[model samples]
Target: MKEMQGELATRALPDLVRDLHAAEATGTLEIEMQGQRRKLHFVRGEIYLPAATPLARRLAALLAEEHSDGHELTALVQRMVDLTSSWREGSYRFLESKDDSGGELVGPLPTLEFARLGGASTSPEAAEAPTESRPSAPPGPPATDPLAKLGGERARWITVPKRSGSFDPAEQWVLEQLRQPRTLRDLLEDSPVPRAELLETAAKLAAAGYLRSLDRPRVETGAFEFQSETLQRLRLRIASFLEEKPLDGDLESQRSRVMELLATREDLDHYQLLGIGPFASTDEVQRAYEEMARLVHPLRAEELGLAESAGALTELFDSMTTAYLTLSDNERRRDYDRQHGLGPEAATVTETSPTAARQEEREELARSYFERAMAYEARAEIHFAIEMLTLATATDPTHAEYFLNLGRLQARNPNWLRRAATSYLRGISLSPREIPPRLELARILEKLGELPRARVQYHTILRIDSTHQVALARRQELEERIAAENRGEGGLLGRFFRKG
Candidate 1:
């Protein structure tokens, strides 16, 4: 079968379809021509049928309506061969719904009426139009693969070119579903747009060649019986609707919402605004902001290792920063508080931007750097600790704990006292209620011989925390020194006057 040529070779359909089914390929199997879409069905290595998707009909209507380019079926078949060379995985990522770009491709396939060579027996006539006015497919069996039941049905198919723009949204959505399979009907029900429009759009997209159905998935029924057989068949058909369609209203609306939500803030701290037990300080906030910005920033999309996902990452960062800034601000924090009926300190809602929701990702990376720096500090490797702390701060400055930790390390190192003081101050600015910063600052002042200032700082600490034993002791010692100095001065003045 692999050894054939011309039309036979150009059409790898029968063999490719069989292999795909054999492997239980889970994603879309798109076949494109110069610009048309073709639908294929497979089940456990069996090539059951070939059909035209609803999207193809929509595309044909569009071509007729716009007087745009029409398609030749043979050329489309050839183009499909050309495309096959690029499929290392032999499948494309699945989409939950048609997108504007994908939908646009479903313009239409040229309907061909064949004329017999001898002018005998059969007469040429236009193909019969469907009885159903709406562009729709029959409800197939409830198998996991939606197209499994429609085998042996010969139907027209079309293909279209890939749309120029970002596929980030489509890619993300597909990946989200890879973790959990969904049906076309489920997709429609979840969409924000009208179901008919969404379906029509998906059909058009399928015709354009951006979407395709999946093969019937193999179900691992118990030891004796295969269960979900029907479900597996239905899933393939459902997969088709998704592959052929652009994103529906729900997906589009959600994407827009994420973008809008992203646009409103600059820092990622709904958690901090809620005051959920104080994991970080101002320094931590700055560190976290920069780190997140690096990951989400449109500019660093390539540099920070999101080259393929540059667009999505950029948009994600934009939303994250916006969210962060909104939550970071006191006034905005209050507004959010009132709206959500939450206190100044509360746990953050899990639902936010998709990008921001990846906290586990951030935390995992964050914890690694934090723990490494702490380990270095524990070993008294001050320089290494400083470097690690610097990286940690850069990655997640919003964590006040990092700043305090860094400052403490600096304070211990003889050569880093000045830097230590700076870090401590930053920590203080972020969290004024913390005692470490206040104590560290007073100690630094005392070390620098700023006795007056040190005493004042100690007094301030006493005011805030009256039971502070260290501050009380320091204040008492400073007072005694002042009294002793006054007595010595008085004695010296009296002796000088007597000698004179």
Candidate 2:
């Protein structure tokens, strides 16, 4: 195709970019707008500004200085989104002849979708705040508006030939007032344009290429908000709670019992799960169930206002109830023993069980991974963040908090909900006393349409903390939903039941 050239005023830069991307065009896009000349060298419609070139290197350096994010292409595209969104009268030429016309990838990035998510960022680990909500420092004058520094040296922000696009006499008069670089504060004080109208005009004129932001955007200090390992780890431990304090002895022991049941010897048969010999009598089983209840009930957690603890405790108690029910009957207990290869002589599991030893033998090299995972999350590098957290969980699978943190990050994206479910399951398995992961796991399960499993999760949570509003409400919702589904299936009993 012949080289294409057009005035930016006729077609916006983003639209032009979309067209180039749609056509999968291979070329160098040359743009002269907003009183500045720019070039975007693309290979098959993707940005390929190799740092081997001077322009690319300069742009890279500027992006590195201005944007805290490490992904160079993402930052560059974000800058393009910001600048191009306002372009009014600029000329763009697309030349399909380039050295890298072979379609070799520079980086698998800066796609149209990638550019859209650039404006906002959320840290997957520590601290949560929208970047747009934060105030930007005006280069010259103090303004209450987010788009501060209207005039003054900031006036040069529009660059020379501020009147780049065609404008009426009134518009020309406004440009004349801005000929001298000055603060927006002074312009509002001295100019005839109303406050609202001036801002509106400035925005409109800026988009039409009448004004240009000559300088790179100033990122506020500490915008990324990376926290220390100690603080972030503590935050992970606390889950949704704002404060962190040592657990009470009784609550801690109860949590320990739940963890031991959920994780340490999870391979046990029902008899072993209930901590009894295969031939234990009904009374013995009853005694064991009662003892386990006292150890695993959420009442202590509820009393201490530990919602997280209560959630996990509730889950443990549910399992104990199942085990109790199964072992309490002679036939079910015998059937369970046969399935698990246990006999009447099978001994109770001891501290030296192979499962516990295997857990203890896992590597503890997750500190570095944890640190990088947070940094990657803050940069919106979800893939890298997931990779790092996966490594962390694998290397130190015993750390309940690590799994919890990983699940939290995975839960941020809808596509990752399955992975998030796995992570939460692992977290609760490792630290069966933590209520947050259980609640999250149930929520994710509900979203995934695992209603029965979610209902069980909520039921367990209620077992620990009877007053849990969300669990109570969601469980009722799930009950109704499941019942409705049963009715649709033509079941005589619309009040449905499901196995965990």
Candidate 3:
């Protein structure tokens, strides 16, 4: 074959360049434009293609053009750059080639293999052995936004990035798909990998701790149990509060009833919560407040690090304070009683006296009309207050302070427990559905040793709110009492007096 070279041969040189490169032919190559020619030299593995125009020649030419300096070379080079970019994408033949004879022939030589022109031996083994190319994966189902497919329940999955290691790719895929509660089966359905093989691989990965365990998240029984324990503690506090006050013979029993009512519930009404029957003295109310406050006060919870229990602490404090406050005020108590129909009017006082004796009694009553009043004048019912103050004065007349206050104020002070118990009982009478008074009556009943009444109250409270504080506390106290008895704290008398 004749190899072409030089100006006449330059026209045919473009097509034969591929053949020369593949064949590893070495020689100088040249081309001409208009009447001028440029030579590019090649020696062994080295190539030298020199610039025909000076650097910055066109940029300078543009500046000169503004000044009307005529220079066509810059435009020509720019045209060549643009042409090269376009021709490379299309088919372009090497227009020069050289033979060992170094002849300047102009005719066309044979066509060259474009594919092998830039081929560098990848491996000696590849050259020796012809291996079959593996079939490529079918293009993935038209690319779609992965995020758009996640729907609403998307927080469950987390994105993980590519990493190193042989198992990394498989790990990443599993992690990406492992939404909580979504089993391996669901994950496999969405994956591109074959199910059987993927499952086998997934199992292996799980065994190696590279995949999540198949076990479902366990319910936290501890938290539920903790709540139950807290309720029990509240009941004990209520019990302790009542024990400090010795109520009227049956009042203790009534207080027990209230404790019983509150035993099983977490939230309790204030009036019924103490379990004291209506008409508790101010002293008893104060005592109950103190006892409960001691147990449930937010300040007390500092030891438990309750500061972290932001919500629970606030709720507990509010509930305890509210219960105490509601049962402590007389007017509120009376209103509550009136609403429940537990007014003192409901209790009938029997009279047994003849007309002459009754006439004498009226004469004496007229002389001391202030002896039995039920209203405080300072609070808008002077006559009622005077009547109560009169009686109080008669009882403790030696105290000048008592007499003056009674005469002036109509001392109609009601006992805290009495008012609370009255209110609670009224609540029960009015709304048998309500739980607080029932719980309170139960506690008071328990304190008075009326176990049956207390039990009924506790049962009722539980029926309404299973987690009543007094009820739970009483249960815990009873359990502890039992344990103490086992340890001989109550002794022989305790056993003998034990309720069946």
Candidate 4:
């Protein structure tokens, strides 16, 4: 009834079994030796082995080979005991379950003779003995190695201590799994080693407390802080959807997407509607249609701000569905294309990396959002412009121009100065050699009253481009003011560092 758990190295599994036997405890003794797990069932002090397990079957086979007459089950139990008693490194737990063992048993154990050897080989070479000679568990139920079911490539983990150095092939593979906060799925997928071995080794390491499972974070959304109500509303809803763990749905662009779909739906042919060329490869067309479906999914109407124009949205979606149906079929696609007079160009599969392909797609989509952002900026719809730019940056953060413009727009609002500074920093990181972002960053820093940092930034700009007039003038003026303040004379803005 009391707590029961400890390492076998010190506690000794034999001693623990003797305790359980003395208490007449009815339950299961779970042992984890390195990575291997084995269970012994007890019915009021008498031990029982789960039928058909490797150890059980091995003991049974050995009994027949020995031609033992002294209760075959007795010899087998002793053999199981011998194997377990020989284990010096492992952990153990005793779970009391008199009501039900949750285990199917083959036979009872012999504890009086538990420590006695049944002439069964417990040697290192004996462990490598063939399965036919060993008593294997019964096939009543599937294997209980539930950890092996962590078969997903997306399942991630983190390493503890993040220690390094020499490792066996298995250890090395597991280390790769824990190299970063990446998923075991990715680790297992990328490795050429057998999954069973890798998983088993990982299990052993985990048992030894060498690895830790991670609650991995979602994919990056490019750090968007939406500045408009509509976009913010959509962002929150998409976030909720993601939290609910949908199989797959569009968490990409929303309101503007509906507008784009409505504008082009009627004019573009089926192939064009699907955003594929006449001779587009099958995979390309399929992917394009999937994107279209996500955008026009009727369930997304309210969040996308298309509820008012639901009729148009519905019509566009129908066109998309028709396009997919037609283009997905080779014969139908060919006929539809012929009627449209779109002659086929050789459809060559470029075999581009999926990551590269996705990057290119994002670049194109973000460009559209960027152009729309500029239009909104031109019309003085600062909030709308900010939203579009947010989308552009979130979609493809590699573009320096997106962040530069985003910071500039955000700077127009006094309350957004801090965020503006962050945006400018991101832009500078992406475009270190480009002067525009650094200049804007300097300006934002000044507005935030970070005069010293602003001055430093200006100095950085001058280093990059000595002829730049604005940076030269700003840096010189800041230097003079800072110098004046340090000299105990108040500068233009005010005294800095209390004139000390």
Which candidate number maximizes TM-score? 2
lDDT of 3 by residue, 1-500 (tens): 23544332222232334334444554655444433334433332123223233323433444445564333433333332222211111111223344433233211111122112212232335334332331222222222323212321121222111212465666567765652235443464355454434445555554333332323222211111225455457546654654665234433343333333333225234433443434466678777666545444444334434455435544554555555555566766554543432323111112221231233333343233333233244467664444344333322222333333442232123323333333344346445676554665565555554454455566556667887777867756655665666666667766665642
Model 1, global lDDT:
0.43
Residue 251's lDDT in candidate 2 = 51
Model 2 residue 400 distance off true place after TM-score fit, in angstroms: 1.1
Per-residue lDDT for 1-500 in model 1, tens only?
12211221222333333334334442234555334444433332222222244334443544455554334443332333222222222222121222222322342122111111111112112112221321222232344332222211122111111223244444334323322224554443243343334444445444332333332222211112223454344334433543564233433323322332243222323442222222344455555554444333454334434367556654454444444554456666456443432322222223342442244544544465678777766796766666566445544555677778888887776677666655665566567677767788778767765565567667767768999999999989988776666666336775676577
Which residue segments of model 3 deviate by more than 4 Å? 1-267, 302-310, 341-500
Residue 182 accuracy (lDDT) in model 3: 50
Considering summed lDDT, which 10 consecutive residues are worst modelled in model 3?
Answer: 83-92
Whose lDDT is higher: candidate 2's or candidate 4's?
Answer: 4
Best by lDDT: 4
Q: Which is superior by lDDT, 3 or 4?
A: 4
lDDT over C-alpha atoms for residue 236 of model 4: 53
Clashes of each: 78, 9, 85, 15
- lDDT for model 4: 0.60
Residue-level lDDT tens digits of model 4 in 1-500: 68788776555555556566667788888888757777768777766666666555544565456565566556455445434443556788998885654367644456646733422334445445453454322222135452433433345554443233466887876765564456665565444454456667776665443554443223211112223454334445544554564425333334533554464354345654665545567888878866666566566677766678777765675566666666767876665543443424111112243332344555676687788788878898887678778656655666778988898999989998877876676566567778877787778778777676677677767778999999999988888877877776665445555544
Task: Rank candidates by TM-score, best first.
Answer: 2, 4, 1, 3
Worst 10 residues of 4 by lDDT: 342-351
Q: Which stretches of candidate 1 lie over 4 Å from their true place?
A: 1-364, 479-500
Per-model TM-score versus the true fold:
0.28, 0.31, 0.19, 0.29
